[model samples]
Target: MTDTTARTIPIEAFGPGAQSVDVPVLDSHLHHVEAGEGDPIVFLHGSPTSSYLYRHLFGLLAGRGRLIAPDLIGFGDSGRPEIAYDLADHERYLDAWFEALDLRDVTLVLQDYGAAFGVSWASRHADRVKAVLLAEPVIRDIESSALPEAFVGAQRVIRTPGDGEKFVVEDNLFLTAVLPGAFLTPLAEADLAVYQAPFPTPESRTHLIRFPRNLPIDGDPASSVEYLARNEAWLASSTDVPKTLLTYEPGFLVTPTIVEWIRENVANLEVHAGGAGVHFVQEEQPQGIADAVVALLARAEAR
Candidate 1:
């Protein structure tokens, strides 16, 4: 059974915010920023970023639907428990959040790790999902050969045992460097700080450090690869659900070859070129992402 009570929790306002709501998902309180009315447009962000990632879209798409962006359990303004923060851990909290809120006919807007986790959840409940919009989604296992050499080297360093902890946790490289470097237009210091504020200590960043490790590398993390496989099959077969993939120039996850593969493979999935960026398209391309969501809703309505 799912708890449908909407509990408002206190969240520190960062930049211009929406209505910040706190709902208990599992033992920890999960925080989300929300606004608007009518059907729900739920924004799920990737690593190191929170609902703050969708601040720009909150205003842009307020008229379009009910906008909700929740910080995944261990990240953002949400509670950080002393847990492993693995793929299953993330899904548990997210599932609870959805049930607590009783979100239905949802338009799931996803990016990065958000795509990996959210898409899998949406696929499982295709009847509940009204539509899906993806930006630089990690929908399948990636090839090392497809990535930039510099990025590959950094990934290796992050994957190494002690080096991974030192680089991501001790130095907070994801917030300080990797995140800033992903944007085509550099994020301002204040904006950067908003992303960095949640994980002030190494202990706070257990989830961040574990995110890259959760990636399906030679199927070592069997659970994550299984989820990816499920979603990929869902994308290929689910025609009733409206799916949109927003591609960008110099993209990281959705390379040119992957774009072609998606076009040929994923059923009822529309691909839109969203201009230039590598990974964090939200920083540079919020309006485009919002527009795509609005369009998806309209298309779904028409059907």
Candidate 2:
């Protein structure tokens, strides 16, 4: 029924990641892996990538605590239903996951596209969040995005032209554009298969197709306008939560101007070495990120 022609990608793996990997019988409900034993920390992956994205973090934190990372629906080994994907859809999944696992005292490690999903969840369940680590995270409204012009122009091309829907998600250019920018090093050719494995059909790209244009810039793109507003309000008022921006070396997210916007606009915000590290700082600087998270938890524990 599905095309098997996609090249098999050897998704990166780490034996040293988390101490134990227990996949509950949840099935395609959400492709997940759990390691270690302690307070639960769920890592949410960005679009076009799966739990495989956190391969390094799993190893780093598995020993000190519990780690759970899931592939969002239509992204990884998870089921790709024929449905529209949006911020609310992702929030629903996050709620179900936390409730299903009975998660509490959580620390969220979010990056890239995952920022939308994780930030939405944090805002909704503010009391449960213990701390936060955001790397090259997306927090801008559509108009304010500091992402390269090339990237934004492509987004406009694919979403406004009506025909943008066809290629935005399905075009190999999406993968080409995102890969080298986010990770510290050029991803191996084999790994590209893992990232590209999920969307094998035009229909399956429903979420990928819709994700970009949904940006809430200048409130033009109706759907995302409100979401960006809600998330910003939450971030601005989340004084009780311990929030840290683990930047990368020269960061891979929007641009420096945008980063300055976050620093000046966002309240209760702190910074780490995120802007100075590689794109996959979690992988390249897993220990430092993990240490920062643990320290946040420790502060929470102390409180």
Best by TM-score: 1
Best by lDDT: 1
Cα lDDT tens digits for candidate 1, 1-303: 222334322233323445667787788878887877888888898887888888778777767878888888777768787778887788888988888888899988998888877887887777888888889887777777788787778888998999998989999887788888887788888878878887788877766878887776545467777878777778888788888999988888776666888888788888888888778888788788878888888889988
Q: Which residue pairs show collisions in model 1?
A: 9-22
TM-score per model over all chains: 0.92, 0.82
RMSD of each: 3.4, 4.5
Residue 274 of model 1 has an lDDT of 89
Model 1: which ten-residue window has the lowest total lDDT?
1-10
Tell me the TM-score of model 1: 0.92
